[model samples]
Target chain A: MKLLEIKNLHASVAGKQILKGINLTINAGEVHAIMGPNGAGKSTLSAVITGHPMYEVSEGEILLNGKDLLSMNPEERAREGVFLSFQYPAEIPGVSMVNFMRTALNEKRKYHNLPQLSATEFLRLMREKKAMLAMGDKFANRAVNEGFSGGEKKKNEIFQMAMLQPVLQILDETDSGLDIDALRIVADGVNKLKSQDNASIVITHYQRLLDYIVPDFVHVLADGKIVETGTKDLALYLEEKGYVAYN
Target chain B: MCEEIVLKANESRDIVIVNEPNVRLRISQEEGSQLRLHIIDWQSADNDVHIEQVASNCVTEIYQVAYLKDNQKVTTHTNVRHLVGGGVSKQVLRFVLSEHAKGDFLGTLYIAKDAQKSCAEQSNRNLLLDDTATMRTRPQLEIYADDVQATHGATTGQLDENALFYMQQRGISRQAAERMLIVAFLSEAIETIRNEEQKEKLLNTIDSIL
Candidate 1:
């Protein structure tokens, strides 16, 4: 039943230690919120799990359904159903959102030994997913995140999540830079995609997002490790009293 | 000096050159004439293009893209002369080089006396896929006429590392990501072609080479 397991993970970036040792396990149909201060290595944890080339994993083990994940490349990790919604999504000029998404979806399908979608089927699926994120058809012709507003970029990230349908979705500070309205719509879209067969990892600093996408488990990460893990009330407790308690 | 050609009033011309052994063109435009020129070089030694607007209210546009690898070297020179007022000229050029390939671009724009209110702009962008690839660019502007608008810029760089990682996180290999970024870089000029079939063919050729 366990979807992802991080055991004694230690990682470093640019020769500086970030993640000392992180151990966490997630089952199917569960939402885990990782709350930490600015330098607590929350993003580093996500990057290491996703096999970012910048990070040097000095020690530890990562497993997706008991398969060794650290041995796989970044693209291989993605094909294994791991997704990271980047906090600062890159802007690719002259590459349309439609072409990018189709290539990604088809690559995933090819990895799973499935046939590629026909043009009609691909467009139909794109329309269905775009409607979920309230994205307009104009985005299909425009470049990927080239001229999009902050809110639109965040929405586009979620739109991509819908198109890829990864089993283990990691939302890395998705609520940052989002207005209240954008936050609601993004959280709503994420909520609609939750199923019993998939899990999520929500990384954020504020508890405002937890009120919308309530997490089943909350973990306090400080000094490169999880200091505490508790139920939903822990989020409220941390909201009332900030991570200063853990500090 | 290449043989000179002229376009009469109210005329339009579209010229395309691809991997020619030698390219030397000089065109003179009469009143109310239009010229659209494209120069795509996969491998070449030298290319020279000059467009002169002799009368008023003429238009000129030039687009170029060059892809080179190994020890190939290419030099391109463009000269646009505005003799009368009420004319417009624009140029966009791109170069992609890998390995030990070298590229050079010299763009010259001149607005003669009494050629007031003429507008001209030039942009040159190059992509170096390897450390040894070299690009030399010189954009010269000589505007004797007062009350004219002209601008020119040039830049050389590598691919975006952040964008590459973003794509790899979405299941695209690094090779594929590089291809996408390179196509995105050069496609800006390719998009301006008026013919759809030619545009598609050139796009496919670029993609296949990449």
Candidate 2:
């Protein structure tokens, strides 16, 4: 079954057109990789999906399981299982990781009308997720992304994903700036969390990540539109050829 | 409203004032005395805090946090005088205003002659949630002793939009995210409470208000 369907998506930022009419569909358990060079509106697509206020949806319809997504606010979209693993996760100076994740988790739960998790249960869940990311106990006590290294920041994003367990996760350049070891660990965590009921869109510029989290479909996004679509090998072809041909 | 208090030699004092209407105190510190104070205001409160290190080896620390909303106005004025050598004073003050509320803070630090080796520091930060809310801050330092060290800074501005958007994208509602950021912004003063239970209560109170 289709989990997300974007119909004629047209979005803009600050009165400048970026995404000119795009369409895509993702089924359950499928991984879609969006590969493109700089200024191809790669991040813009994710921002519009998650309802970033900075972007204006001039025209489009986004459906999550046939429910209208564009009508919902950012938090509402997140509650409905649309997550964006930001390329640059925000540094919250004084908000602790535990507090941040717990608040977000509880807020999602509350939206679904579930009872809040007890403090002990919540802590245990945090510990489990942190362990999955190969993070330490001391991490939960520190401020969110305050002093984290690049790899640690990306790992923290995955840790948050593990905690939230969003169904439609959009990882925008999650592999960027990651060392080989950190990339493997992040990919491993992503692989472990994959399930038939969830789907992900891996947005990146390099095909190196596709070797780890192999995408079922590879789409080339250039000039705010998907120029081409192919199988996993298309990622290889793009890596060999680069985005120059599409541009 | 105006009161005079003194910390005797080697004396240590801790004070916390919350939701108080008015505060005016003239504090005197003797040799080796110490004073730590926390002030939190929510309503219309006028405060004047003055401290003088009359003897050597005196220490004074002040932390103030005020969260005001809906037309509430608060003004706090602080003056610290290092009259003797070997004195240390530090102050941190923060105010968050929303919905047409107004806040003002004036801090003055003075290191008199012969007060060599005295050190004083003061910082004030304010957050105006919306364009309607307003804040005024002043940090004044006068040092006559060439050997003393003194620093003071004050700033008032809106909440960080990047930080707010970052939280919203993480599935936290903008309002909740703003509350979290505000609480975090005020944590410098909140973390100073020594009593755990009181600290938790204050934190909870701040959260509930947000």
Best by TM-score: 1
List residue ranges in candidate 2 displaced over 4 A: none
Q: What is the TM-score of chain A alone in each candidate?
A: 0.98, 0.99
lDDT of 1 by residue, A1-247 (tens): 9999999999999999999889999998999999988899999999998988899999999999889999999988998889999999999998888889888888889999999999899999989989998888899888999989999999998998888888899999999999999999999999998999889999999999999999999999999999999988988998889988767
> What is the C-alpha lDDT profile of model 2 across B17-126, one tens digit per residue?
88888898899999999999899887879989999999999999999999999999999999999999899999999999989999988898889989999988898999
Assess candidate 2 and give its TM-score to the true structure.
Answer: 0.96
Choose the strongest candidate by lDDT: 1
lDDT of 2 by residue, A29-73 (tens): 999999998999999999999888899998889999999999999
DockQ of every candidate structure: 0.84, 0.77
Clashes of 1: 0
Q: What's the distance in Å from true for residue B153, model 2?
A: 2.7
Q: Per-residue CA lDDT of candidate 1, range B1-210, in tens?
A: 255789999899887777875788999999999999888878866889989999999999999999999889899999999999999999999999999999999999999989999999999999999999999999999999989999999999999988988998999888998999999998988888888999899999999988
**Cα-based TM-score, every candidate:** 0.98, 0.96
- Record all residue pairs in model 2 with backbone atoms less than 3 Å apart, i.e. clashing: none
